[model samples]
Target: MVSVSRYGREMGSVFDLLGTHEPALTAALGWALGRSPELMSRFLNRLGLNGSSDVSDVAVQLETADEAGRTDIELFTSTAHVIIEAKQGWIVPGEVQLTAYAPRLDAAATSGLDTRLVTLSDSTAAWAHEVLPAEVSGVAVIHWSWDDVRDLIAEARSKVRGTERLWLDQLEDYMGAATSKRPVTDALAYCVVISNDLFGDATFRDYVVNQRVYFHPVTGGGWPTVPPNFLAFRWDNAVRQVNRVVDYEIVAHLSERFPSVADDHSAGSRPPGDAHVVYRLGPDIPLPDGGIPSGKQNLRAQRFWVLLDQLLTQPTVIEAREATKELGAT
Candidate 1:
């Protein structure tokens, strides 16, 4: 009954009408994988199928029926043929279904193609790997979870641009919602870079230290669709204040909050009628002596999320960033 409004239309999604519908979700992923070679490569590599050649002229087939059963998705590249059996829940594909797909894979292998059968399910990778046989009828079987695909898309984002980037974003959003899997963005803390001019200004520091609120324009693509719980203020080569985000709202202008302050620039250059995201914060937690140093690494001006524990425990920003690589690895 729920839906995500995207591309200007309200349509059923995997979280709603298609929640347990295998073909629809399978087709959605197949479409994106067929279009983006980088995504395909990353996905195969994540499954430890690194020996397979890069995707070239890949084709995706959905619900192709044979005597045994209907396959959820079928992928073909010049050098390989991959059969995917997708399930919305943790259940493994029945022997009947596996038997249906194995021979087709064997025929492809006989034709001098790298044949593989992949199971995309809601179960943990460890469970699927343990129960599912490594090979079926001479073709390799790889187990993967929706969570794994979501993370792969997040990683592949850096390797793509333009339409490919947009496709990956949409795919990631859908998969995250469908599986009720919160992306890494939700697990981390958001860090904002305070400009030098504002960092040195007493009024700005006072408002943050005393008043305890931080805000930024909600117009940029840099902001996350879902906000994180903690916020860190970075300036003067260190993270000075780290606070829990109590609430956030969009306001029309600076005068709405600070009516008496004559300098409007303190709240930032608020274009008339523009909305900003104002984050209400709790008391700042004391950081280690000298605060968390930025060290030699140059962080971009845009806001980014960092593992909260890493940001607090690691001595330098670069080290904290390095620690974040281990996030979700387990």
Candidate 2:
């Protein structure tokens, strides 16, 4: 019951897998927070530690060990020392495990540094409220979900540009996908029409279409986070082929899916090593006659959905969409 994005990656895809792993999630969050002062500030503020200064030299460490065992993440700045205990899925941190880390915070406080212990899990903050004492060994406790971290990164993304923005974008998407936790449902009886002019390209016709596989990057354009059941391919002002989705996979690179023909530039320009979601489509269910035309309006590379039956009965794309909407209302 994996959830898949229609034009992009599916649930439990490579990206989501990377995110679900506790250590990877910790490393990613630590990396972004340490590099971006703005993001770090927002994070501290959310923990009720405001006006934090002299944080320019924040250092992040993972799996730091002491007599109390290893903490998941540790952040050391000029004015603050923070220890994070992160757990993935539905697991909750035990009170004994949390209390063991309290000594480190209290020790840091002796040096006149602001000290706190933060617990991160998939559960809501109420778990933190109930499990955590009023204070752990005199060190304040803070709770946060993966979603809170995602929102902070998203909010900070708008304020910066260039590489900073790029890092946040990757982190935000990863966290969002991981926290979605959507339960799988039955495939809908819907069709997504995709406009592609690659039919004129012989390599695409021979290798891609003939192979019945379609791949696209997860980023750089508009794509769904959840895949629909059917896909309709439109070209030369008409949609002639409608295929049911058989299976899909998310790969870190295109070569993983098509090694023999990876170098061929026929199926449009897909740079190697870029994350892509590839769909295995069923045999073409060709439309009748000259296929469904676009009528007077020009629909160029536009992705839209219509009821499956509308594609077989309607003569034009506009009429198909209108009829699909009408049926939906009834």
Candidate 3:
């Protein structure tokens, strides 16, 4: 005999109810875009939409086709025609999907009008930007992640008041949860060390010594080295503050033996000079306000790690060009 379960009947979230229906999601987003100028500004900014224009004139869910293929959202002004294709979850919209909308955009384009294609998804739609036929469509393709939208809503929430503020607050909360649950690729884990005397320094200095000693170990053994991507901070004991923050690229990891200067340096019967891990760091890039506060250091790191990682991952476009020229010289 099978017993029927009766506990799973509750209605889920508003977004959950919307499910995979792109049209419905488009409508919900369009409504938000219609009401919030700040949201519209950010959305347009992500598409690389430039110059001074009336965001109030922006329209959404404009019917560019009647027979099953229509652009999801369109913002048309005197200067530009921006089309957005939005997707929910990890289900990516393919190039074929975008190409279908090209003819409509082509027909809509007028002389001197800047046409652009944009793909919005819960996760980074980098593939869409890569595959979309920008040359054929005669439009630039840009991808905006839901995280970008959340940031806009957060910005809007700060400046709005009364009913608008309340609605934006709710929307921001919803998007925050939605984006948080989306599966991330190359997700990073962070560990921060906060101490009154990280390097026994109370003031900013050019460099600091990090010492490591080992006991009952092989002669070749040494302290574990930090990754090139790791960050280190100096906390001041007297002021109960963080004096500096440094972003280091581990150029070299060197070790050598040092004679024991004090009894504390020795381990049991073993004399000093066991091992050392010298982390040669890169130049310092000081964060605002001297350094991140000890109380809020973790939060600050968590917030900026992604952006910092992207910077560290590759050289800038200008840098790349310079490197290419230097390579040719060799």
Candidate 4:
């Protein structure tokens, strides 16, 4: 039987297991996108990637080696010099490994270089950020605290929440005026909310953009119960949208409406199957049927007159200047 957890999106970090010494050290991560070894390693594992001899670690090697000893990293990058430092505990990476190793690595390379230090302790990390100078100890220092790491993770989700909320407000205004003329009491019909309008009809083009969209299973009732599906979008190909996280509140409401309507599509651009109605919310783009919907398509030019009139006549430059002056005086 298909399961519930099947709907979950994979959660990962840039760091993976660094070691038992500190939390950040042994984590998995994909890119040195300036994350700890542990976080970076975890990111890599989530995507199923790892070190191969074919890949270049110039960034890796130049930061790992010490001056006095011949290190594997220095030899591996095949450069004249290498400087990479790994440290743990209250020993202080900035004071000891990074500070000591950076110079040696810088000297080995005809080019300027520095090692990266990834550590576990929050206190040490705080010290690194507050005390460490920009280019000392032969390397450029980047430190991550437990608080920093937690905030980053929280920010990822928070961004989605913020975007969804903002767009929801815009969507309400958009649907009311954009398609209010249509008959909601009539048979079931769908509405597509967009962020920007990017479509044209032979001689004319219109763009009605909205950041959020409200989806409903059964379309017309006097102020129909708020639609269930909400997909937040970020542009990818300038044409396609990505990142569809189903909110728990949204999902809970949806479950109430569609007890059997839930079926998970594969992550990313995979098409939704067995879906009753589909609505996209993202940047402005042209729909297959042109920018105008069924009811208002023919009256678009006339409707444009209505919206345009509201914009031009509602307030003039004189009023704007008066308001501005009044505000400045206050």
| Candidate whose TM-score is highest | 2
Between the candidate structures 2 and 4, which one is better when assessed by TM-score?
A: 2
Give the runs in model 3 whose Cα sits over 4 Å from its true position. Answer: 1-21, 62-64, 123-130, 133-136, 176-330
**Order of the predicted models by lDDT, top scorer first:** 1, 2, 3, 4
lDDT of 4 at 126: 31
Q: What's the lDDT for all of these models?
A: 0.69, 0.67, 0.46, 0.29
lDDT of 4 by residue, 1-330 (tens): 333221131212212122222223321211232223333233223222344122334234322323544322232233223222333322234454445455554544445322333332333343355445555654444554434444433333344445433333332222221221222322212122223322111110111123232333222232222222222121211112222212211121232333432353322212222212223344432222222222312222110111211212224222322343443311
TM-score against native, each model:
0.49, 0.50, 0.46, 0.25
Model 4, runs deviating above 4 Å: 1-19, 22-24, 30-91, 107-109, 112-120, 124-134, 152-330
Deviation (Å) of 81 in candidate 4: 11
- For residues 1-330, could you state the per-residue lDDT of candidate 2 as single tens digits? 757653343544334545456778787787788777778888877766674644567788888998889998888877788899887643447778989888878767999988888877654454356556656778887777666777788788979998778778777766654443323332223333443334323344343367787666644666644444677776678776777877665566566666754555543665656666677888877677887887788777677677767767777877887887776521
Pick out the ten consecutive residues of candidate 2 with the lowest summed lDDT.
180-189
What is the clash count of model 3? 0
- CA error at residue 256 for candidate 4, angstroms: 55
Task: Output the worst ten-in-a-row residue range by lDDT, candidate 1.
Answer: 11-20
Ranking by TM-score: 2, 1, 3, 4
As a whole number from 0 to 100, the lDDT of residue 91 in candidate 3 is 34
